[model samples]
Structures are given as C-alpha cells and as structure tokens.
Target: MTRPPLAVIAGTGFYDLEALEDRVEESIDTRWGPARVTRGSWHGLPVVFLTRHGPGHSVPPHLVNYRANIRALADLGCEDVLAVNVTGSIDPGLVPGDLLCLDDFLDLTRQRPLTFFDGSGPEGVVHVDVTTPYHPALRRELLEAAVAAGHPLRDGGVYAAFEGPRFETAAEIRLARLAGGDVAGMTGVPEVVLAREAGLRYAAVALVVNPCTGVGDSEEPITMEDIEAVLATSREAVLAVLDELVHTRATFTEEGTG
Candidate 1:
C-alpha cells in the first residue's frame, strides 16, 4: 500500500491550503493533546494539512503542542512534512516579499522541550543528528519548485527561532543576524528538532513578511494584522511551490512503479 506523499504544517496566518479537494477535517489525539488535521488531495496528490495554531489561531508560540502535531502525522503513516512559516527578515535585502528555504536553525526558544527523548518516551535519549537540520533533498525540491514558479526564493538560510508572542527588540535582532540568522520567527525550533527525531523528512519554506526590528526603521510598530496581510502578496508563490513539490513527488512515485 502506498502512503500519502506529504503533510503540511501551516504556521501563523496560513490556516489551510484552500486548493485542497476531497477534504475532510479530522480530529487526532496523541500523547500531547488533540489536534485538528485536514486530510485531502491537493493537485491530485494525497496530502494532509495541519494548522500549528488551531482552528481559531488562539495558541501562542510558547504554548503550541509541537509533539502532538508531529506525532499525529507520523502515526497516520505520513513520512514527510512541509512546514510553511511566516518570518521576519534579518538580512538587508530579504524584504517582506521574499521566500527562504531554511537549511539551518538557531533555536533561541526558552522552556520548550528540545527533544522527544525525555528518558521516558524512548529508551535512554536518542540523540538524532541535526548536522543538516533541514532535509537537503526536500529543500532542493522546494527551491526548484519556487524558481520554476517564477518566485524569488533564497536557496538557503539559517532560521532563528524565538519564543515569542512578541516581536524581538532591535538589539535582539542585531544579535540574531550576527549569529547567522537570516530569518526570525516563533515556532521553527522544536518542530524541526522533533521532526528529525521522528525520522520524517522535513523542510521549511519561510515567507518573509516584514523586516526584523532593527534591520529597517526600528521604531515603527507593526500590527499582527499587518504582518498577516503580507502573506497575501506571496500567496500565489506559496501555493505554487507547494503544488510543485507535491506533484514532483507524485511524478517520481509514478515513474518508480512503472
């Protein structure tokens, strides 16, 4: 039996892929808690979608159940995950309209469990290697898809994950950039970590929605709604890249069977 090709975990303002067909909203229970998953077909590819926040976008970054989300998908026989995250740019040129293929991450999250091995879930502590944080093959597919779609996607960048319901300060942004952070966001840390632990091929497509606090005019305050609105600008690119990745996988699967 062939399992589904991929599952998407949408972040922040991205709730679900609206182009999905033959969809059903599923409620899944894991060791962590209840999570809602959208089971459907997108571009004729069997896929599942899960919103990181909730149906209402109420869960804050610190409070999100990363364990349950990944666990549910893995339990459902899903082997690969595409995480769509909205981020702030740390680089000078990567403005609000660019997309980044996240290859590495600097996790600055405080109090979030960095690993699934708490000496209880699995024997001892299974130290999974994160030398290559993002799956290289998956990143390549995403990049090819983005370029083919005529979208400007940075081939590789380091994501700095912040534990936030609040945006970073100027000093923090500066420090982040100095530490090799190309993009900054709230939830990339443990999600990437746990996905590696789950042995699932995972990759992230980061959409830059605004300049980091210090990179641009640091004093100007931005609303969450304002950040969300920027996603609309790259909405087509995001959808197209996702389609390309899924369709590309489906094509390979078909060829291998033939």
Candidate 2:
C-alpha cells in the first residue's frame, strides 16, 4: 500500500519547519482560489506544510480561503491533515502554553465559505457527518507521541471558532464556556469542516496562547506580543510532538506493521 504525504496546517508564528529538508514552495490552484504550500520531507515521510495566514501573516482569520486550502491539499494526494492552532483558553484551568488535542468545536462565525458542496456539483447537496470531527486514530497517535516525548497534552478539548481578526469579548467567552468550549480560536471551523467534506483524516492540536476575556484572573487585554512570546517558547514543544508522531509512523511503515 502506498501512503500519502501528511498535510500540516498552522497559523500565527509557525511560518516554516526547519526540520523539513529539500523544501520546495508551490502555489496550488483550486476551484475556489490559489493556495500556497511548501513540499518537503520530514523524518523520512513526505510532508505538505501550509501556513494558513500566508507569508508574513498577511491574511486574517475571516479572510482565509478555507475551500482553496483544503482542496489544494486533497488535490495533492494528502490523506491526513494535522492542524496546529494558536488559541485562547476558555477553560479557566487551562493556562497559557498548554497543548490540547481538540475533539469538538462550536462554530460562531457569521460569514465565510463553509463548504465545497453547493448542490452544483454532480454529488448534489452533501451534508457530511461530523459526529467525530477530529479523526480518532490520528488524535490517538498525537496523544501517544506527546506522552512519549515527555510533553503533557490534554487529550480532549472543545474548540470554539469565532469569526474574527479581533479578540472575543468577555460575554462571548462566557457564552462559549456555557456551551462547553475549552478554547477559543478564529480559524478552526470551515478548515476542519472542509477536510471532512474532502474525505481526509483530520485532527488538530491547539496551543493556548492566552486566556480569553474573563476566563482567568488576568484582567489585562490580549496582545499580539503576549501571544507571540508564548508561541516562540512553545513552538519547539509542539514540533517535538509532531516529530515523534511522524517518526513512529515511519518506523511502523518500515516494519510493515502500521
């Protein structure tokens, strides 16, 4: 059996993976739009790395072309996607720099292209089932890898996706918490949804950058500087987990036992 390359999507402070060798940048054109990605190999496994925010973080959350990104990855023969999202903690106990493998989500976005199926395609109107939005096997692998790497990762978390370039308000965070949200982010929605629509195994690991408004004792407002500082410190830890996961996969493939 042939294994497809792993697709990794990330935003905010993760511009490139230094461990990736022989990198080649490409612009993939899809029906929705053009998406940029880097092709490389990591730990003897092919990888497709995409920065959702574009180079230099030029694109904002609400403006991301979710359909194009997802389509491009699918078109490139990627069967599994690993997403890393920087988020604010809605759970009061989750402090900054905590990592969680998200199991569910609440979409609060008002506007954006949410699907590839518009009833125009030959498949007609399609409503893909998201009973398990994040692929269970992939999530398990991530958790195991994190543990093996000696990094503590919360197994299950609910990610609340809000439409924004702006941070959420206290009332909004409270509402999300009421709905069982553990973390809040701006870009996890349609991306995850589209991956499901495309028949790709998808999972996400969220890095908590700060506490959402009114969640913790910090009355201070969220700032880019604060988020960046945490990202800078925690990026290595996140990458280590990914490395462990991919290395394990490579080893299993070599042994013909995965």
Candidate 3:
C-alpha cells in the first residue's frame, strides 16, 4: 500500500508553503464540518498543507474549527503531521525569531471541541493518553533538520495554549510561567489532542514572535506590527528547517531506510 502524505498545519503569518510544488487546493468534509487544504509535494514527497486561519487570516484562534481540520487531514491519508505555531516567549531567555521543538503542552483553552470520540461512534467515550504529547521520532527529525538547515531549534519546550483573539495578560503569562510554560500561543491545544486521537504522528515547531506580557524588561504591550516584523524575518528559517526535513524524508524513502 502507498504511504500517506505528510501533513503540515501552520498558524498565523504562514499562509502558504513556497517550497510546495504541484499544489492543488482541496476541500474535505468531515463529521465535524469541512476543512480546506492544499495537496502538493515537497522534495518529491507528497504533502498536505493546512492553515489554521482561513484566507487573509480571517479566523481567530478561539474560533478555529479544530475538529474539522484534524478530521480533514486524517481523511486525506496523512500519517505524519508537522505543525508550526507562532508564540510569545514565556521563558525569559527566549527572544523573537527563536525556534523550539515542543515536547509538552498546557491546554488552557476553555471552550473548544476537545475530542473526536464523543461516544457517538463505534469507538465510544475514548480517552487517549497524552504522556508524550509530541511524537519523539518526529521531534528528533525536526531538531536534526533545523541544525542541518543552520537554523537550530531548541530541543524541547513546553507550550501553553491560551484561549485568545487577544494577547495574554501579564498575570496570565506569569501563571503559565509558574506552570513551566516556555512559550505561549493561542492555537495548539485541541488540535494536538485531536491529532493523537486520530493516530497521526504529530510534532510542532514553535517560533517565538515576541516576549509575553511580562517577560524581559519590556513592559510594552504586544502589537501585531511588531509580531509581523518578527514573522517577516523568521518565517524563512522555519521553512528552511521544513525543507531540510522533507529532503531527509525523501532520501530515506528512496533508500528504503525510513
């Protein structure tokens, strides 16, 4: 049987993958709803790309249809998912443009569909283990690829997912930091949870776009203009890491060593 394509799910400032070739947009229907994706290839390997926010970044993190997006990727025969999340540094040492491979997450999202198995289907009331929320092998590959691309990612970090269309408060950032969150973002929770439920090997690369509300000496409020400035310069580094990863995967597949 042919192997499923590798999937990449990205949020904010990442609308498309410039490296993806032969791209075709596809709208997939799921029990949850519908999701739009671009099917293409990278380094001669099949890939499925999904942007969490809709065109022009119209969708906010709190309003994203996580179920539909996860279901769509699963239906598309995607076995491995590589995700990118733009985050603010909760760890004082981190700066804008720094990248980290996430190993754990604290889901602080209050209201979102958290699962696919609602006991409505044959599976019924399923509880998936999240001891190792991020897949080990995939995380390793990402770290290795980042190094290969000269954009080394910090090996591990904890991601805190907040419910937001707005930036977090200083107190909220402090709370997350106390809980060992290294970075904070809006859209990592149920998506990662749902990916595990779907049996897809998932991993995420976090790009630090700014210091969270109270981190560092800056008391300045977070602004999109500053965040966009970081993304403008940092996006290519994330893409470079991904490019190397796809090239490595393609090589391993050709050599039958994957």
Candidate 4:
C-alpha cells in the first residue's frame, strides 16, 4: 500500500499501464478544479497514471484542464511527471513509430490558460522559471530506458503545441518548422508549464503518429484514417516504453533538476 511517487501522463489510445497491480481510481482536488487519477503499483513502485485525454478519447486537447492535472499530482507528492505525447512528425527522420525525448517546445496555443498564477496562487505574482522547460536529467533517464527496453529513441526534439480540437493546417506545419519545431502536438505546452511551476520534475516522450499537415510520405492531405493507422502501428512501441519506464522508474531521481 505504498504510494508511488512517479506520475505518468499519457494520451488516451495508449493504455498499457492499465495492467498495473491494485489500480484504483481517486478524485484529486486542486485549486483550479478536480482531476481523476489512477493509483497503481508496478514492480513494487507506486505510480499515478492519468490520460491527458480522458477515457475513450472523449476530451479534446484545448479542453484539457492542465492546471488541475499538474496540481493534483503535486498535491499527491509525485515528484517526477512523465508525459507521453503523440505527435505529428515534422522531421522526416522522425517518422511514425519513432519515439523522441523532447528537449524544448514552441507554444502556438492562444486559447488555453497558460499559467497557474492569475491572482489566485498561494503567493502573489509567482514567477516560475522555464529556461529549460523540460527537465534534462529526467529526459536522459527516459532515453536510457527506451534504449534498454529495445526501443530506438531519438535523443531530442522540440514539440510545438497547437490549440486544437482540429489538426493544424499545412501552412501552419511550415510555420512550425520555421520556428524550430521538430514535431507538433495538441497537448504539451500548458501541461509542461504547469508542471514546472508546481515544482515537479517533468519530461516527455513523443510517439510520432503521422506527418504534420504536409510533411509525410503521402502527397494527399492528412486525414483521421492516416493518423489512426499510424497509431495502430505504434501501439506496441508505446506499450514497451511505458512499461519499462514504470517498472524501472527510468532511473529518475527524486531530487529533480533543482
């Protein structure tokens, strides 16, 4: 009955962690709101797992309550938060099925709430530094785990976050690359920022689900079918990395990047 100090925040289609022992649902309340989190143990290590998109993939990206999720984990004493993002490949080399440990990000989301401080924080005018938004030590630990688990993981990439229930346009894809984005995804921005502000060591591993609006093998426009197919093919890779990370805790330290 020991509580796991690690938190894994993944997408909906990826559900490998459901197999954890003694898994139970818990309602976590935060200053922003409440978040539903799953508590479980893997290899005797406690893990708190939650999907960025809710069960059955019903929740849209822009609608995700990033603050509540991060706050809930922080309140639960989770020190390391690992986010598994499904991204569109902007780099040709980072094609579908490839896993990349993100090093940076570009926020193009205009509609989502970007911070936890809006005169409602514990301290007034709280300024959290995000010079290195993603924690390096944690990323290195995940990269090592991915390789050890037999998954070929790219060491680094920049994930661009788009405000979307809808996918980005081809023109936007072009703009993403110009802005130094290696891949694009709907989630990853506010979640990451919130985690940093919450004092949790955060890292993300991206599974390239498809090309951005116009960067893949197909000359035709990207569709839901294409992404679905990519996801189907990537299910195993996703399962492997996640299982390995949880079982081993990916060699992450509780001290974090402080």
Candidate 5:
C-alpha cells in the first residue's frame, strides 16, 4: 500500500533533511510559479521537503515564493506540513538555541504574495478562518515529540513575522516587544497563513538563533555569522526533535491507516 505524503518546510541553516536516505527531486508547477521539491523517506514514512529559502539559501525572506511553495506541496497531496523556522529571541527566557513550538503569529510583512486567493486564479477569493493559524493536532504532535525526544522546548510562543532580508532595528524590536511578540523572524508570515488557506495542517517549530536586536548578550551588531554559530550548535537538538516528530507522525498514520 502507498503512504501519504508528509511535507516538511525547512528554514534557514536547515536546507536539507539529512535523515532522508532515499530521495528524489520533483519539480512542481503552480499558478503562482514553480517549486523544486525533494521527496524521500523518513523512518519508513514518505516525506517531502522544500527549502523555504531555496537550496543554496539564495532566495531572500521577502522574495520567497510563499504561494507557489504551499501550492506545490498541496498539489502533490501533502495533507500536513511541518514548518521549521529560524527565529530571533524577543523574550528574555527564550535564549539562543531554544526551541519554540509557535502557537500564534503577528504578521508585520509589508508586501508579498500573502495569499492564493487572487481573483485572477481559478479559485476566486475564498476566505479561510485565520483565528487559529496553526493546526491543533499537528501542534500537539510536535510538542509531544519534543518532550519524548528529551529536547528542551517551550510549548507555546508568539512569533512575530517581519518582512525582511534585513534584520529588525532595535527600535522595531522594542515596538514588537510592546506589541507582545516573543520571537521574531522573517519567513513565518504568508507561509503559515497560506497553508491554512490551502487546507493543509501546518505547524512551525522555531529555533531561536539570536537575541532580537535589543536583547540578550549582544554588544555588537548582529550578523549572519552570529546566527550561523548559534544554529550550528542547536542543529543537533533540532534534528532530534525532527526525528521524533517523524516517528510520531508515522505512529499516527499507522493508527489511521489501520
């Protein structure tokens, strides 16, 4: 019997799924554009991976083809999506390398294709409820997997999605903190929102890579080098969580398939 496709959307510093042994690249065409997706197996379960920032991390945050990426996964029969986000810490408690299972988001993005519902598309404006953006079941599974894997994880946090290739200014970070953002990042916005619109179960596991402009132990300006260092150290924890997540999903699928 054939297995269902489970999609994993990888963020910065995590462009590839090292655990997937048998892999194949499948290019998909969507109304917005095209996405080159990687399909493979994770612990015997079928999985599909898409680098949100492209394979070489060439695409900037603001330039990511959110609509096309989500559409491609949905078109390929992906019913559930695990979005991996690399974020900057806003709350003092969430330090570099901490993992957060995001429960909410504030979109501060200015411009991008935020939706699939352009009246020009085949399906005209179809508004989906965004009251609770992340899928409940998926979020629960992720949290459970993290606990089972013995990885330190914060169960819930608000992710502030900013429009950027640029890091947030200190002033902007202060403003975001006032607005109740616990974690800040560039790629979570339209991607999570678009996933709901596509009728796919979506949940994000964010790894805090740095202190948001004004916080933590930073005295110098934040740089890609700083973020990379933090992510490099945390990569193992993230992978462990992912491995458990894949196992959890496989267990869920087995029960349902039975």
Candidate 6:
C-alpha cells in the first residue's frame, strides 16, 4: 500500500479523522519514541491522522510526546501537516466558533522539550528560522478551504501556547494579549516547532471555543462545563474545516505533481 503524504494532527475532543476512508492503523517508531498513526484515504488521496492528545483524550498538553509525534509523521513520508487546535480567543474580534489560521506563536510553555536537535542529533545546536512559524502555502490553502466551506475563518493570528492542565487566569489572559497574542491555547507551540524541525510544511487551524478568561461578559469564571459546551456546539465547524482541508491537500498534491 502507498504511504500517506499528508498528516493531520487532531486535538481536544477530535481524536479521530472522520472524513478519512479505508482507514488502517500504523505504528511508527522514531529515535525519540513510537507513535501510533492512522493511515487512510480521503477523496482518493492518501492521508494520515494522529491524535495529539491520544485516543481517549487522556494526555495533557505538558505530557504530549511532541517530538515523537512529528518524527513519526515525517517518517511516514508526510511532507505537509495540518494541525487543529482548540483555542480561547484573546481578542474580542475572534469570537467563539471562529476558525483562525495561525501565522505566529508565542511559546509560554516552561518544561516541554522544544527541539529535535540535541547534541547527539543530526544537527548540533542548530537554529531553524521561525520568523514565519506557519507555512504560508498551507495557510493559503486553509483559508481558501474555509471560504469554500462557508465557515467563519480569520486569515491570520498569533497563538500563545501555555503549559496547562488548567485554563488560564484572567490576569494571564490579559498578559498574553499584551504580548501580542490573538488566541490562547496549550498545544500549538512545540508541535508546530517540531514539525518545522522535521522538515515538514505545517499550519494550524485554531477553533476558538470560548472567550479567554477576561475577554467577554461572563457572569462567572470559565469552567470545564462551559468550555465543553462551547466545544460541543463548535464541533461541526471543526469537522467541516477538516473535510475542506482533505480536499485542499488533494488539490495541492495534484498541482505539485502536475
């Protein structure tokens, strides 16, 4: 069977790629660790899906094996990756259910391993240019897909990634906004950075599930129930975008080959 050329990294409640056809599980081993990946077909194009938070959504952001996940996808011949992140809007303009194609990121994570280049790896102490963190070509395709799907999508935004099992406090949200972040989430940083280090084209479609701690008029504090409720309602939008993304990947590959 032909290996998949594109991979999707799913987050939060979205652990499986529902749009994929003829799916099969493949376990991939890398120097860092092993990642179990799902290989499948979408619209006759090969695709791979990896649940960033695992199948049962048991892994926390801080504990996710970012390096292993990126390495596994790269090893599977995936040249491009589309990462879906569920985020909270730091800017009022970015409302719940808005899809944001992130252009930049601010890493607020404290203890996760961020790079593939250890002293023993292929390149020692090498730096990859992150001036434009998300791949421009992929970003364009994502925006076009959003338009075709008739979804509310922002062309670009800055995502701030924090270390978390807990949601950010209002003070922290304000601080992130001051730091030039448009959206706030826990999982976008090391994954995007790791993909770049693995030499794969990457872009993130961030689904804003709620207003960040201080952005909207809420009588009470943000809770797990509230977040889950918003996510449940916005789940359809996420699925719609994924369908568009799969089609976009097919188009991109066909054009590249032709």
Local distance difference test, each candidate: 0.86, 0.95, 0.94, 0.83, 0.89, 0.86
lDDT of 4 by residue, 20-59 (tens): 7899988898878989899987666778898877777878
| Superposed model 6: Cα runs more than 4 Å off | 1-4, 248-258
| Candidate structures ordered by lDDT, highest first | 2, 3, 5, 6, 1, 4
Clashes of 3: 0
**Poorest 10 consecutive residues by lDDT, candidate 3:** 249-258
lDDT of 1 by residue, 1-258 (tens): 475647899887788788789999998998878778999887667888999998678899888999988888888888889998889999988888788899999988889877778888647778788999899988888999887777878889999999998999889989998899999999988999999988899999999998888787566776788787887777678888888877777787778777
TM-score of each: 0.95, 0.98, 0.97, 0.91, 0.95, 0.93
lDDT of 5 by residue, 19-79 (tens): 8869998889997899989999998898999998887899999999999999999999999
Per-residue lDDT of 100 in model 6: 87
Q: Which consecutive 10 residues in model 2 have the weakest lDDT in total?
A: 249-258
Deviation (Å) of 26 in candidate 1: 1.3
Q: Model 4: runs farther than 4 Å from truth?
A: 1-4, 249-258
C-alpha root-mean-square deviation, each candidate: 1.5, 1.3, 1.4, 3.6, 1.6, 2.2
Tens digits of per-residue lDDT, candidate 3, 1-258, equal 345899999989999888889999988999898999999999889999999998889999999999999989998889899999999999999999999999999998898888998889998898899999999999999999998999969999999999998899999999999999999999999999999999999999999999999899987889999999999999999999999999998988888854
Give the least accurate 10-residue stretch of model 5, judged by summed lDDT: 211-220
Encode model 6's per-residue lDDT on 1-258: one tens digit a residue.
343577889888787877789999988888988898999899779888999888788888899999999999988889989889999999988877888899999998899999998778657888889988899998997888888888878889999999997889889989999999999999998999988888899998898888988797874676767778888888788678768877776677777777
TM-score for model 5? 0.95
Q: For candidate 2, list the clashing residue pairs, or say none.
A: none
Error of 4 at 55 (Å): 1.6
In model 2, the runs with Cα more than 4 Å from the true position are none
Candidate 4, RMSD to the unseen true structure: 3.6
Clashing pairs in 4: 4-46
For residues 1-258, what per-residue lDDT tens digits would candidate 2 score against the true structure?
A: 758999999999988888898899999999899999999999888999999999999999999999999999999999999999999999999998899999999999999989889987898998899999999999999999999999999999999999999999999999999999999999999999999999999999999999999986778989999999999899899999999999999898889954
